[model samples]
Target: MKILLRPVGLTFFFLATHLLQSQASAPGGSNLLFYGVAALALIIFFFIVVSVADNFMVIESKQMGIKDSSTMGLFPNIREFFRGKKPGYLDTAHVYTLTKGYDIPMAGAPQDVIREPNVTRFAVTPPDYFGLRPIPKMLVEEGDVVKAGDPLFFDKNMPRIKFVAPVSGEVIGINRGLKRSISEVVILADKEQVSRTYTLPGREASREELVEFLLESGVWPAIRQRPYNRVADPDIEPRDIFVSTFDTAPLAPDLKLALRGRMDVFQAGIDVLRRLTPGLVYLGLDGRGEKDSPYSVTRGVEKRYFRGAHPAGNVGTQIHHIHPCGRGENTVWTLGVEDVLLFGELFQNGRFDTSRLVALSGDSFSEPCYVRTYAGANIGELIAGENVREHSRIISGDVLSGTKKSTDNYLSYFDNQITAIEEGDHAEVFGWLIPNSAKASVSPTVPVLSNDLHLTTRTNGEKRAFVVNNDYEQVLPMDIYMTQLMKSIIVNDLESMEGLGIYELVPEDVALCEFACVSKQPLQQLLRQGHDTMIAQG
Candidate 1:
């Protein structure tokens, strides 16, 4: 099956390319030699394109409630989609809680949880992703006794930021959350006042000093940079830095909530990050309805408003949009809003704090809210109660891009929620052909069904080969040509891939493209291939 399927898939791609070229108008600057080969390539390409287009099954977005004309671009053969009967769910996984964590379809089993040093406690509250202007304040003031993981305060912002206690002890002096009128700080002290303190391995401090300190202290693993999503190397000086104040995915956790009461740690993290990169550290925030931010302290940090979904706030996307990477350029590092404080505290005192805020959502989940969890900790404890409804699918992270990890699986570098939805079992006689009105999203491009605000926990359609040209670009905010880049990488055309800005991409950027692909190509694999290929060449 693998051998037969692989060749067929490749044939489809080659044919698809020819089909696109034929449809597109050629540039006037083209020479005779180029045209000769292009024409010859077209001849052989036509047969393969026609064969694949004829044999393959495609579902039209129009019938599925996709009204946009532009969506046809994602799928090569949009006209044939509405031809026959509609199809049902292609792949389905039950959302369950095992010893590992939440069980998802795509992500498989979760990796073992790794506990870094100096973790203090955990705390959280309602509305993990809230709008700006109303950052939550800590419930406990200076010198107040609190549990290891307790609710610090409710965010004053729209969605509400729930501050969690880092350790069980008396409250310490608030940091910089306080302002002329608004304040948003929560400080926790260790009960013994021992674990609360952080110290570098050596007394002397310089840019290299802190780097060496973090590397030796085991807190170095806490700093994760992008492109490869690995721990930032202390030895290397990063070209750029990125920080996001909020997430724009469907159910992303609000940084304001996660960062509440930890403004000092956040400030400290920023200081450390700046030392590693002489270039600017771009901080992304939501511009829509944003008021004054209480946690922002980095003096020269270039702040930008992310106005779209998913990748809009992705550090990789921000870097690609702002300062694109060129050949031979070093890495660009990024930090999560909450992790910034953790790093700060790690150097300020020697304590390691790994607690984080996790959001629980999905159609099958009875309770959809944010829970406090320790970094790299097992997810089973965070997502509680009867998660599975008869047979449901639980995915860690956003539905479109997240992996279907097991309940026992540990969370990854930049993830916050476990979304559970019912495994769609119902079959339709003409599901694909019919104008689906039962609140199904063919892609973000469809109007009647695309924005159907009534998305439920039920798997409306089966996860077949990703069909439908959803507005993946709307969610994926990047400078690279996602579609073209994927093709170049697949064909191993290094020069074409580089020309299309392959260096500025990461696997997560293609997650939306994968979800919105009509061909259901594994976009993540394609991105991974590009990254691996580029790295290998380097």
Candidate 2:
């Protein structure tokens, strides 16, 4: 199955090079020498011309483009990305600028939730990657009175990176799953719970000192590494850091609107993150909007604009485009803009300030607005008002990559957007035959039913065999052989996975691949399992 179903993208690449080599060595080899040399010469010439053209475009773009607020002199990432001598990685600067993706136009997200709501409860869980679980070390038990900034729990594997209490509250209870792994650390907020203060060092701290400050203050787990999408190791030094300010997912919240008055803390957070990596700190913004996008106004980081459909605002996409994560390149870390402010505010004010603007969106709700609330806050009241439909799926994050939760469930500790989507169960007559113009699908042969077009908690169809269609590649602008990687993962071939560049791939990186897959095989779950298997074998 694996051998038979290679991704077309890789197939064309292999044939293009290997065909020339094999033919050159065939019968009457001496007769074909001139043709082979001419072909090879042309290929080299084409490559040189393209590189020169790209360099010209970069200079022209810089001369005409407006400078960002903080002009950090000489970014090495941009330089290395263009003049890179690495194999298996495309020059992303050109690829990203030319890439295009499908846009799922969702109404009601433009309606920002701007009202400040009261918060009396909060919860923190070892964030689940969909149904995939994590092993957590419990730091506090129920009925224990804890102050804000106090460590609640941390990954037992990476104990130095602690997950802290978002609010000053009493430990009410714990939510667990199979195997008794720690789940949610439910906190009943007193609102006046003791302030676990953070004191900044007087002098500018060294790299180790800054790491200690972030670790001790319980804010270290906020930024996650890309290779495994796991909590970054405290001991390992990062190569580069990525901070994303906008989300390009369907019904994504507007960062410019969300962080309107929070630039001070945002800048402070950027300063702290700059110390984490000796390399560049890249900031990705939504370029589809205005020329002066609010997030583009920020200072003190390497700025890059990505204007495309969904996943354009994804940190993995930005990182891949700006600087592709290569083999053993585990130093890249991505943090949300809101989480950036969380660390900054925690460091500056000496108390945990978990208040952030969460955009509640979807067609289910009556008024989809941005609400000012703290992390782990019981979103029950926030989304309790009259909604358009029932059996709605309330997720703590965006449509893609967000975890599924009930309306009563508290927001995930790491999520900044809560979404409510309608339930999907009913199957239509000839569902795969109806053209779904209302919704966007990568595949053209398969027509998605109109009623099936909307967001739902259900997988519209059943799982089937792997089909190496161009649909997945059309939606994903990243230069990866999706079919080859998926086939390798399905067979649990670690060597093949590594050789195919699975190091740079994450669950979210393949979310679109799953959606576009006619097979309906859960691609995210497979990627997670494959990644974990690699770690377990090691």
Candidate 3:
């Protein structure tokens, strides 16, 4: 079935790609090469053949795995180009078998150096954001004094996974709403910012002891399961664990810059993590470096270097290439680099410090920079005094997958970016209807957008019926049929959803599909709804 659609996906993309590569001032300059009648006939015929073929396709058997190396993987890809390729990385010969996912045109990457800040008051958000509805059980009440590394709350569903306080302070408030579930726990810090240390059983601590300490210190939330993309259940042992060392998202925080001078602690965190799983702890890092970036050099774990675009840095993508998660299988657990640093700090020096550097970016600001702050810090602090144009948006993460927020809101617990972008609310005479060669786009049907462009909330087009054209297959490197999965999702077929490898996806993985959909469907939202339904039932 894929062999039938492969040419449609590859050919259509090549047609638009050449326009980007052309040095002409405009996509066809004055001649309008792509607009010629001959081109129009071919375009219409191409879509007709694909749309007709896709309409009759159906999958009766359930199967999930990486697209055979001879074929495409998640984000069916290209050797597009790597501007930041380091020596010894990205060998042209075997790249086809090695990498997946191509970097698309995007703007607003933070280039600022990381710094530390002293936070007066710190807060911790509930773990429910990941869609893990942990029944909130508060361990402390308002005005109660507590030390750093102390427990603030625990999941009622899984009491062993505790939310730890980051600094010594008084519990200022237990912000709960509706069903009396805890929403936020605010701590008014003591002037000295003290932390209580633990006398460990030593470096030779057993796996069970390590797991217990992580839970006691409130670091258990860092280990998240994949089948559900939620906080891992400490009770169920995982088959393997993954840690992503690079940030390939547009304007992603530089791991090498962020982890500077923290290698010892990072390594210690790796050792600590090793104790929690009897399975291998896979660390994904950037292979584009001539010499191994400090982020990739660690001991006691399997190090896999990824050499491709955006989602390449995503642990989910890496997991697919390494070990595909299938329905009813114990999910592969993934941890972030920051989570490991803190987890190690709890055991290394017994001091808890959540303060770290955050990247501020987007075209709305005059310049992009990094600010030192703690998790859940006030969002206002990061954007103060910036040239925030009228109708500008402040996002808590990257533009592709981040949540928009008012400066008044607190940052999310796992966020490391504060993006300020202009809202694209104003309309154009015939926006996206005519050729605008100056614009950047990956679609052959739309105006050609510059390779580097700023995006907004503009839908650009209206929602329409799901088209069976092979456009989505071009962007996703996964093995499942893009159209079949969409068909299953629209009708809410849980069995088909599972068969389509829904367990191996998150919104970030399909965000490009949302951007490229010709029908302007809220693809990410659909994918989110589809997964949420499955997880709620899983």
Candidate 4:
């Protein structure tokens, strides 16, 4: 229709102009009424032809799976024209500048200096990974000496995915929790550390071979899939893979500091990840950093820049904006920056090197700094002699989403930071009624005098009515309606939950919302429940 209209419209238009010209040139004066009517008809016909052509082009582009960015109708797309543009510092990378989300300012950010902590104990906990069946089958007994990369256990449901030791050591203890479920597989590190090596895959190795290598070597658990936030399935291919190069949670370790002098290894890791997925591997970089950030130069992945407060650095946020995982079979894998480095080290040295930079941070520590330690290093040893307060609460990971740990416990398997904060056991006189300026808050009721506020374990208020307000929306940068979604989860409305975009979320993604919630609702736990319900229903 468009092709047919173009030529016919042009011929009629030219003929009309000629007739008008010929009439005006005749001996009789030009017919003013006829000329006016003819001009109006020509203008209307021209617009109709263009509108029809535009619609046809849009339809054809949709049929061919091409995105049409041009203006539709007779005018421009005002919304796109007024939409926020990418910051000048993003360079050529795709940019997602989020305006929502809050940054919880607190004291005890880790210093840049990296110290060698005398960490002699490390453990691999099975509970860290979601969707794992209770009590994974053990591969080693206590008192067995093993090298790094030696398999310690495997999920009984998926026995191929092995959990390996972080250091060459003696299996000192196989700790158990309630119902005799395996909690921690503790290993006492040796003075002389050794690692087990395996044959590297060939240059032309297939994706299945790479998956098998990762599974067998125990690095596959680092690659987690969305929709359940569990370890990526070995049999299923992800639509895409995502890695956030920076951490934005409160007191989170600076990944740039961790990325220093490891660009080659990181690139190697990217190469390995690329082969596993037929889709592109996406790298999310901090938009506030320099143009020459090592992550920006990384090849074999799609680079995207994110600038915002807390959740912007989250890979879930990046995935939601870039390519969200839909319901059902749609899945996307996500890995932390250190996880990628692990893969790089595996391929580079043909062994699993669990060496990581752990940040010791919080107000309780006398000197908060970065420490070089193995994965699952003892939290007590990591923070030994750093305590300044008489009573402090130790947490493995960032203050927001980290697990509470004690001096006797080891670090969480996936965490790279240990935080120590004051234990808020003492009760305050009318604490809720009295607005303390020293306390940090997202609400306007409390006056926050400074950026850094000393936080504690105390929930300022008890659970109240789940009020429908912008509080959760203020901190959650994603498009999903957090309040309604939580309500859906509470009511167990599976259809409504799915429609509210529950698949795109993980607990950490909503940690900020939980912090900002005026009702003091446990949003992360609720989201986890929603995920479990969806998985069970499927």
Candidate 5:
């Protein structure tokens, strides 16, 4: 009907205009006013009819699960382009071009070459995880001999989820922290590592069987749910599962190197994850670097290409764009690329292989490159003989959002990169007044000659008043008002936090915002407090 009406409307409009022109040319213009009024009325009626027909078409297309590309109007696709609404599930991949973000250009990105590090000591720290009890029930005692994948400890609250050892080793030490809280379970890895094997689930296995397998095999901790960024509950099925195939953090490892020769294992992992959720498994890919990459050809998942600066590779940011988590009872599971490989190893080899490629990067080291090691490897052994700068800070992950650690500390369970940068404790004379080209600044006052900058552990400025401005919004790519959300979280306003889309965020999502803030407010810490408050309320 819309197609037929187009020609009829055009015909009436032209006829009325021609009649009006003829009447005006006639002497005294007797019927000029009548023709003019008729032409004006016809124009208005034609637009109204077309608009109604367009609405009907849009509604019909939506009902039929079809994209609304056709309309009897001036511009059909302009509205959609401005709205930036793209379907998460489609035959072809969806591209998300995020413009609101800042990529910190830091020196010391790892080389493509992978090296085997001599990391013998490994430890499983319960405090590394969020919401876990400070004193978890220990499954192994000191001097106990256990194989890789053996249960080290279990949270008293969630006894089903077991935290396992990364390698065959003996329990060397069980260290405690403030208030005698269990800090680290140190292990001395044996030369010949052995693994505990289990029966692989069948292809026709039920969801319960798969969940039970994951829980018992100690791989459940890899799957963390948002809204609190804690371990996923075994009983409640998530609405969707998300995985980011790349990392965009400063001095972060190239994930393509990690995925090398592990394509089959990665696919098997994706297959296992598909059974855990009824919704689509979303894979966020790097739009700038995924061309000809192995992850591009990955099957059985919805691929979303993200292009932008830092935090573009963050899974939380991707989740916000694709399918945001709602305030209450909307759970979304997220995992890293390495976590998926562990799942594949469990199903294929019948053992939880925690082997991963850790990138040793930053300007502190003489030669930065990739290191092949297991999870929770000792920081000292990983970079034992490397030439490192004096008075340097060692971080268990990337500089941004990574935990600070000493040489004696072990890597975080979820970290795949270790960063070392110079400490910024020394005082600088006239540093605030002088503009140094060597320093990298988001502000135009300090000249940044190149994107690759040599940064230190310096805040540059101290915390002062929390001014209301667009500084956070300039770096945060999501739709949430970052400044307002931070303020709400500060006052412990639960109602305002939920309404501001706090459920859709984790600490890493706002790490860039914290970095870009002129006030230097600890946004990540503040966000964690908000999460704790929300969890306590329930």
Candidate 6:
């Protein structure tokens, strides 16, 4: 029966094609019988193709251990570019360090610990602390002793939002910042066991109900929308959603570790996001995740393999390839994999319960591993530096993209990694043109006699204008023109930036461009500037 059907299927497909072609060639006196037969054949052909594809479909599962060399790992790739080239500037690159007063004076003795003005009353007044898309109703007042993960406030506009407590302390403080007119709800945690479970709304949640749930629960504040980079408006429907698993910047977090035990939460978050958007959730997995994720089209999720150097793993590149945000028609909302858990927590309970796993790495560190910490939590408690290093620069994120954090400073909204590299006082000889083998870190174009990956993270060459043209293309796996888009952003060309798709990029995405940059320009600053300009204009 199967063999008989095979010939019938093929014959019908060809017949349909011929009929359509004949109609195109001879429009007048078209046969009604031919039209009916062609329609049937076309439908049958579609089913046959679908059936075969379903049977032969491959399912890729994301596993923990899979190590592959970088695109530069291929020898011919490196040699092909360096063929018959005298290794001088590429070998001895001249870069200018653009220090924009980020350099802070070293703390004299014990640095004063200043409580974050925002987190002061966060526990008692959770909703007041976080900015929701629409404002929420204040639940509790001052001096209310709240337990960890307990609801603080709910969004009045969409009441599902439930802001929760970060620590188990007391409600000791409450005050307002000068401008922004946002309330400051302080919560000191109780340190006692608080019941933290709620019945999750199953797959049957209606769009209106889900929006209400998020607002009342307080987690709605976490879902920020783009165009203006403001909190997402529940009233305004979005076109698609984006989530970046790993940050590929200089001192970015090890997202693989961050998501290690939280796979369930991550999946839960993805599941929730799938509800809000009409299109597919394009998972921008680095080459690693693309080969591993296991999801079919029925799941409404599509996976694309992003293989690049630094910014290659960025969400901007992912958006540019999978679902390019259009001008005034399509809007893409991007979130870090770490924060997605907060969305998942919304359904489980009215609490903000995700403490991210971040890493602190640079030339100044003797150890670099994942640290379990919460958003807006003080970093001084987790970092230990008195042993081997002194006078080192402590960066809040990756060295290239991160901000200069005070020793007394708590981590801010955009930090995933804390890098500590030494601000060495070693002076060099005519550093711009010298073979910086001992001090410089170059890519395929090594300095005169320097090719070592196992060296300290000190800048060997003088910071000139950014110039090294390493293998950015080899690592960047996006379809859009990266260099051109970057140029448009620099010039503040809003129309061009939008045409080139600026909505896909966050500051951390451009860190790799800074790391491999020969001109040594701060690419993050440029990206942030563009983001700010766009938001302001909007």
Best by lDDT: 5
Q: Who is ahead in TM-score, 3 or 4?
A: 4
> What lDDT tens digits, residue by residue, belong to model 2 across residues 1-538?
1211224334644655676778778988765766766766676666556545545555555455433211222222243345324222222322234254666555556384487666677888775422224667778888998988898776655667777888887899898767887767888888565768777864478989989888888877777876887777777778899987777777777777757777777887888888888898888865554354566556778877766677788888888767777535456888887778887786656667877778888877777878877877787866655365677778778777788887567888777778887777766677646664655466555454442245565555788778767877887878788888888988999889988878788887787777777789888888888887887886
Give one digit per residue, the lDDT tens place, for model 3 in 1-538.
3444568666766765575346245654546544543465677677667555443332211123222342332222333243444455434322213344545555666665544444566678784357645447778889999987788877667778877886788888777656866667888778777777776757777777767777776677877787767788777777888998887776677877668788888888888877777788988878765766686568999766666666778787788777677554456788888888887677677777776678887767676778876667767655664566678888887777788888656677777888887787897888866766645455666554465577666767788887778667766667767677777888999889888888888777777667668788777788878878886776
Candidate 1 has its poorest 10 consecutive residues by lDDT at 93-102
lDDT of each: 0.54, 0.71, 0.70, 0.84, 0.85, 0.54
Worst 10 residues of 3 by lDDT: 58-67
Candidate 4 residues lying further than 4 Å off, grouped into runs, are 1-88
- At residue 481, what lDDT does model 2 achieve? 81
Task: Write the number of the candidate with greater TM-score, choosing between 3 and 5.
Answer: 5
Residue 155 in candidate 5, Cα distance off native in Å: 0.9
Clashes of each: 41, 5, 15, 0, 0, 54
Compared with the true structure, the alpha-carbon lDDT of candidate 4 equals: 0.84
Taking the tens digit of each residue's C-alpha lDDT, what string does model 5 give over 1-538?
3444556667877877777778778897867757587767968776777668677776665445342324323435443446533433332556666777877878988888778878889999998789999999998899999899899999999999999898898999999999889999999999888999888779998999989988988889989988788988899888999999989999988888878788999999999999999888999988764244469788999887877788899999988877788644578899999999999888877877899999999999889988898999999999996889999999999888999999999999999999999999899888777868877656756677887688899888999899887877778888898888889999999999999988898888888888888888999999999999998998
Q: For candidate 1, lDDT tens digit of each residue in 1-538?
A: 1223346667766765665566454555346446655765776676557545533322243234222222233333333344332212201211111111111222111222222223232222122221223344556677777653344564353212234444566554444433532232333335353343444544446777666655544445445555465545455677888887766555555666766677777777777777778787777655433354454455657665533345566666656655665444557777777678777767665575666776666656654666665543345545644345556666777776676666545454356766776665666576567665454343434435333132434433444543334245544555455667777887899899888877666666566566556576778877777777876786
Model 2 TM-score is 0.79
Model 5 quality (TM-score): 0.85
Estimate the TM-score of every prediction: 0.60, 0.79, 0.79, 0.84, 0.85, 0.62
Residues forming the 10-long window of minimal summed lDDT in candidate 5: 65-74
Report how far residue 502 has shifted in candidate 1, in Å: 1.7
Residue 305, model 1, lDDT: 50
Question: lDDT at 125 for candidate 3?
Answer: 75
